[model samples]
Target chain A: MLAKRIIPCLDIKNGRTVKGINFENIRDAGDPIELASFYASQGADELVFLDIIATFENRKTLANLVKKVAHEINIPFIVGGGISSIEDVSILLNAGADKISINSYAVRNPIQIEKLAGFFGSQCIVVAIDTKYIDDDWFVYLNGGRIRLPLKAFDWAKQAESAGAGEILLTSMNHDGTKKGFAMDITMQLSKNLSIPVIASGGGGCMKDFLDVFEKAEADAALAASIFHYKEIEIPALKKYLNENNVETRL
Target chain B: MKVVIIKYNSGNVCSLANALERLGIRPILSDEPDELISADKVIFPGVGEAGNAMKYLKEKGLHLIIPELKQDVLGICLGMQLMCAHSEEGNTDCLNIFPLYVKKFVINKEDKYKIPHVGWNNIVLNNEVNSKLYLNTENNKYVYFVHSYYVEKGIFTSSETTYIIPFSASLKKDNFYAVQYHPEKSGKTGETILRNFINL
Candidate 1:
C-alpha cells in the first residue's frame, strides 16, 4: 500500500525562505536550500519551494537557489510561483527541481497543461489551487489568493484533471493561517471525486489538525507552511504520531 | 563518449539532449545501426502511437541492434514501453526484452478519474532492487510518472507505481533499464535517477 505523504512548503524570495500572512508581511525564515535540506532530513515526504518573488531578478535568484538546492537535496522538490509557460516549466525542471507547479497560469491557459503534460509527461505538472469560501461556496483564487476566478473550486479541480494535471494541490485561503484545520468538506469532496492524488494545503495548526485532515479530507498528502516552518510541528515526530494513530505513514 | 539517441520520429529528443548536456554528456541523435551499437549508451524515447513507433524501429533495423547491444541501454516513456514484450496501445509488438504486456487503464473514461496517469507518483521498490537503478532510494519513494498504458506487475518489474491500478513503473534486465516516467523532468529525483543511470 502507498503511504500518505507529508510535505512542507517554503516560500522563497531572493534565495531565502520567507513566509507571510495572506501573502503580506513577509518575514524571513531561513535559507532556501538549507531549509529544504532540513525538511528532507526531518523526513518530509517532499518539499515545495515557491519563489514568492517571480520578478526578473527574483526569477534569477530562484534559478540559482534551485541549482544549489538540487545539488544538495535528494528528495522530491516542487517549484512554483510565476510559472506562466512550458518554457518556464522546462527551465525549472532543468534547474534540478522535481515538479513544476502552475496555479494562476494553468487556470488561465488550460491547453498549456495538456501540452506540457504531453511533452514532459503529467507527473511534472502540479496544479496548485488556492481556494476561498465565499457566500457558501468555495471559489478558486489566483494571484496568490487575491483574485477570484469564475469557476468553483470543485469545477476547477475537475478541469485540472481534464487538462492532464498530474496532482491537485488544494489550498483553502480562508482557513490558511487560521489553524482551525483544513476545510475537510471541500477537499474530501474533491478527493472523493478525483482519481488523481489530491494534496491538501493550508490551515495546519497542529499535528491533530493534520490527522483531522487526513482522516476527514482523505487526501494523498498534506502541505503546510507556517506550522512546519515555525517549528510548531516537527516532521519526523509528526510522522511518528501519525503512525501511532494507525495512519499509514513512513516514519 | 558519444551517445546515440535513436531518432525514429519519437517524442522530443531535444529534452533528452538537454538532460545530457546538464550532466555534461553529449550524445548524437542517430538511428544508424553502426552509430547506435558503437555508442556508450543508447536511449530510445518516443511519445506517440506505440505501433507506429515500433514500425519505424523495425523498418530502420533498430529493432534488431537495440536488443543485442553490449553497451548500456536506457528507454524513457514510450521508449520504455517499446522495450517491453507488447503494448495494448495500437495493439503493438515490442522488443520483448522483458516479457510483459502493456495494458490500458481499466477504468471508466466517464468517471472523474482520467486516463493517461500523469504526474508525480511514488516508486515502490519491488524488493529485487537493481544495483544500477535503485541507488540511494528507499522503498516507496515517489518519482514522476505520465502514461496511459502500463505494464502489469510482474517479475521483470524492478520498481512499481500505483494509480488506477498498480503497474510496473520501471523494469530492469541485465544492461537494459527503462522508466515509464520522464526522469528528465522529474526535478531533483529525475536528476539523481539519471545520474545513477549514467554512473551505472
Candidate 2:
C-alpha cells in the first residue's frame, strides 16, 4: 500500500527561507538547504518551497536556491510561486526540482496546464488552488488570496485534472493561518471528485488534525507550515502518533 | 569504475546526477553508444511519456544499442517501463530487455487508491539475502514511487509492491536491473541501494 505523505511548506524570499525555523538542536533556521535537510532527516515525505519573491531578477536566485536544496536532500522537492510558463518550469526542473506547482499562472492561462503536462509528463506538474468559502459557495482566489475569481473551486479542480495535472494542492484560505484544522468538507469533495491525488494544505495544528484529514477527508497528502516551522510539532513524534492511530504513514 | 547515466532528454536527470555525486561517484551522462559501451555501470533514468521517450531513443539510435550492451544497466521509473516488452501507455512497443508488459493502473470506484501511485511504499524483496541490489538493505524498506503504469509481476521480478494490485516493484535479468521507484528521491534506504549498485 502507498503510505500517506506528510509535507512541510517553507516560504522563500530572495533565495532564503523566510521565517527562521529554530529548533532545539539547531541555532540558525534561515538557510533553506539546512532546514530542508533537517526535514528530510526527520522523515518528512516531501518538502514544498514557495518562492514568495515576486521579481523577474530574483527568479535566477530562486533556481540557485533550489539547486542547493536538491544537492543537500534526498527526498522529493516541490518549487512554487510565480511559475507562469513552460520556461519557468524548465528552469526549476533543471535546477533539480522534482515537481513544480502553479497557482495564479494556472488561473490566468489554463492552456498552460496541458502544455506543461504534455512537455514534462503529468507527474511533474502540480496545480495549486487557493479557495475560500463565500456566500455558501467555495470560490477560487488569486494573488495570494486577496482577489477572488469567478470560477467555483470544484469546477476548477475538475478542469485541472482533465487538463492533465498530476496532482492538486488544495489550500483553504478560510483556515489558512488559523490553528483550527483543515476544511474537510471541500477537501473530501475534491478528493472524491478527482481521480488524481489531492494534497490538503492550510489549517494544521496538531497530530490529531493530520489524522483527521487522512482518515476522514481521505487526502493523499497533508501539508502544513507554521506548526512545523515553530517546532510546535516534531515530524518523527507526529509520525509515531499517526502510526499508532492506524493511519499508514512512512515511519 | 566509470559509471555513465543514460540521458535522453528525460526529466529528473539532474536529481540522479546529484544523488550519484553525494555517493562520491561523479557519473557521466551520455546517449552516445561509445560512452555507454565503455562504462562499467550504466544507469537509465527517465521521467517522460513512453512513446515520446522511445521515439527520442530511436532517433538517437539508443534503442538499437541499449539492448545489445553487455554492461550492468539500472533503470528507474519510466526507464524501467521502457525496458519491458510493451507498454499500454501511448500504445507503444518497448525494449525487449525483460519479457513483461506494462499496464496502466485501473482505479476502481470502490477503492480509495488514486492514480499515479505517488509517495513512499514498502518493497518486499524477492531476491536472496546476498542479492547484489539488496546489499545492506532490509526487506520491506520504503522507497519513493511516482508512476501510473506498472509492469506485471514476472519471473525476473526482484521485488513486489501492492498498491491496488500486486506488481513488480523491481526486476532483474542477467546484467540488467530496474526499479519502478525513484531511489534518487528516497532517503537513507535509497542511498544504500545506490551504493550497492555502485559496488556492483
Candidate 3:
C-alpha cells in the first residue's frame, strides 16, 4: 500500500525561509536546511522548497540551497517557484533536487509541459495548479493568484495529465489561508478523474482537516506550512492520529 | 574501501553519492570498466528510460562489464529493471543478470491506482532471505519508491511490496542485488539498507 504523504512546505526568499519557524531545540530559525532537517526528523514524508524570490540573480542562491538540503536530508524534496525554462530545471536537478514544479509557465506555454516531461521523465515534473471557484466554475489563477485566467481547473489539469504531468499540486485560492479545510469537492472531483496522484495544498488547519482531505477527497498527499511552522500541529502526533483513524500513513 | 558508481546518462548519481557520503563512504563516479571492475563494491544507479539507458550502457561497453563483476553489485529503480531479462517499457531487452521480466502495472477497472507508484511503501521481506539487506529491519517498514514498471516475483526475489498486486521489492542473485525502491531517498531505513549492502 502506498502511504499518504505529509509534506511541510518552506517558502524561500533570498535563500532564507521566509515563513518564520517556531520549532524549538534548534539553531538558526531562518535557515532552510535546519528547518528541513527538523521536519525530516519529525517524520515528514517529503518537503517542498518554493523559492519565493523570483529573480534571475537569485538563481545561484536557490541552487546552492538545494545542494545543501540534498546533502543534509535523506528524504526526497521538490524545488519550485520561478522555474520557467529547461535551463532553470537543469540547474536545480543538477544541484540535486529530487523533483521540480512549475506553475504559470506551464499554463503560458502548455507545450513546455510536454517538452519538460519528455526531456526529463514525467516522474520528476509536477504541475502545480492554483485554482479558485468563481461564478459557478473553478478557474486557474496565475502570478501567485493575483491574476485570474479563463482556464477551467479541471480542463487544464486534464490537459496537463495528458501532457505528461506525474502529479498535480492543487491549491484552492478561496480555501487557502482560511484554515477551514482543503477544498474537498473540487479535489475529490480531480482526484477521482485524474490518473496521477493529486496533492491537496492550501487550507490545512487541523489534524482532522488532513484526514478529511485524505479520506473524503482521496488525496494522495496533504501539504501545509503555517500550522507546522508555528507549532500548531506536530507531524509525528498527526501521523499517529491518522494511523489511529485507519488512514495509511508513514510513521 | 573503494566504491565506484557507474556514471552513464542517467540522473540521481549525485544524490546517491551524497547518501554514501552520509554513510562515511566517498564513492568514485566512473564509467570506465577498470574502475568499476576493480572497486570493492559497485553501485549501479539509474533514473531514465530503459531504451536510452541500455543504449548508453552498450555504448560505454558497461553492459558487458557490469554483469561479469564478481563483487557485490547493487542496482536501483531503472538499474534494477535493466538488470532483468526484459522490460515492457521501451520494449527494451535488459542485461538478463536475473531471469525476470519487468512489466508495466495494469490496474483493473477500479481506476483509482496511480501509475509510477510514488512516495513511501512498506516491503515484506522474503521468507528465510539470505541477502542480509533487510537484517535488523522489521517487516512492513516503509521505503521510498518512484517507478512505473516493476519486476515480477521469481526465484531471485528477496522482498516484495504490494501496490495493486504483489511485485518484487528487492531481487538477489549470486553477487547481483537490485531494489525497485530508492534507498538513497528512504531516510533512516534506507540508510540502514545501504549500510547493510556496504557491509555485505
Top candidate on DockQ is: 2
Question: Which lDDT tens digits does candidate 1 get at residues B112-135?
Answer: 455556545678777774646778
- TM-score of each model, paired residue for residue: 0.80, 0.96, 0.97
User: Compared with the true structure, what per-residue lDDT tens digits does model 3 show for residues A96-192?
Assistant: 8888999999999999999988888898899999899999999999887778998999999999999999899998988776689999998999999
lDDT of 2 by residue, A182-207 (tens): 98999999988898999999888888
- Cα lDDT for residue A76, model 2? 94
Question: How is the predicted docking of candidate 3 categorized under the CAPRI scheme?
Answer: high
lDDT of each: 0.80, 0.89, 0.90
- Ten residues in sequence with the least summed lDDT for candidate 3 chain A: A20-29
How much lDDT does candidate 3 score? Answer: 0.90
Candidate number with the higher TM-score (1 or 3): 3
List residue ranges in candidate 3 displaced over 4 A.
A20-29
Over the true interface residues, superposed, what is the Cα RMSD of model 2?
0.9
Q: For each candidate, what's the DockQ?
A: 0.20, 0.85, 0.81
What TM-score does chain A of model 2 get?
Answer: 0.95
Q: Give the CAPRI class of candidate 2.
A: high
Error of 1 at B26 (Å): 9.5
Local accuracy of candidate 3 as per-residue lDDT tens digits, B1-200: 89999998887576798899999999999999999989999998888899999999999999999889999999999999999999999999999999899999998667689898999999999875567888878889999999999999998889999988899999998899999999999989999999999999
Q: Could you give the candidate ranking by DockQ, starting with the highest?
A: 2, 3, 1
